[model samples]
Target: MATRRIISTEKTILDKDDDDISSPVAGQQQSSNTAPAVPMDVILKLLAFTFAMVVVPIGSYFLSVNTFFKGNSTYAGGLAAVMANVVLVGYVIVAMNEDQSDQLEAKKKAGKKE
Candidate 1:
């Protein structure tokens, strides 16, 4: 009786290809080439600028009214001024929160790499 040996060239080549696919070399270059995108801080700055632009006009209106009336008025003008300032404050808060969230997201992404 004679003993025969079986060899698989296809299986060996497939195993080699799989090893190369799983290696870190292929993914490293791709990840390095493409970085994550981040929104510009200029957008937040523009929002704050817009808020200031709006607030200034409203404030000037209140100041003019106060000066014209010698600081005397019914509750309406005062309420309006307060409301305008409150709106300005809200815009500021929103801008700040957006900036903070962006920073946090960037930090989280950085942490993921480590």
Candidate 2:
């Protein structure tokens, strides 16, 4: 004897009515916004500043290293490196400011949608 198979298709309670389903609510805007883009001019300026800090003092230290002991020479090189790092930090600050401005602009645009 051969057995027969049956297939059933039924809608669940959740699928009964489209109108009864709730949509997701929109998210709230946060106070701290993203920054805007940095201009090419500003980027070039920062790069120049960084290069100046890193190259000039270090070169000067190298030129004068013969006049000082190894310890003093190392100290001067370290100071130059720290100054270069400070310039790099300035770049970071500028980037962060740009991001904040961008976020605020985005929030303003989103507010308009509401």
Candidate 3:
């Protein structure tokens, strides 16, 4: 019977001993457990837009299929596509507004510091 030995040269976290283990790597500073780079409001806004993107298209498709289009699947599909684009445009507009507001706030803070 022959035995095969597998050798790994890489030093993974699991392979490190207690003495060799360290939190921060060389020349890297450890950050404090403070607020994230993205604000909660920004996260929520993105999530809401994402949810709308998913739900709006499907809901419009089903609602228009029988209600407005009179079982015309082609028109219903078109409306669904249009609704998706509308949602995308809405998200873009909201993002642009938020970006502009953030820039304004940054300028205000800078002015205060000076």
Off by over 4 Å in 3: 1-33
lDDT at position 102, candidate 1: 84
Model 3 deviation from the true structure expressed as Cα RMSD, one decimal place: 6.7
Candidate ranking under lDDT, highest first, comes to 3, 2, 1
Q: Arrange candidates by TM-score, highest first: which order?
A: 3, 2, 1
Which of the numbered candidates is closest to the native, going by highest lDDT?
3
Per-residue lDDT tens digits for candidate 1, residues 8-67, read 554566788998877788457544546446456656677776876677656756775667
Q: Candidate 1: where are CA atoms >4 Å away?
A: 1-73
lDDT per residue (tens digit) for residues 1-114 in model 3: 999565687555566764354656776887778779999999999999999999999999999899998999999999999999999999999999999999999999999999
- Model 2 scores worst on lDDT over the 10 consecutive residues at 19-28
Give lDDT per model, in order: 0.70, 0.71, 0.91
Model 2 residue 30 CA deviation (Å) reads: 35
Identify the leading candidate in terms of TM-score: 3
Clashes of 2: 10
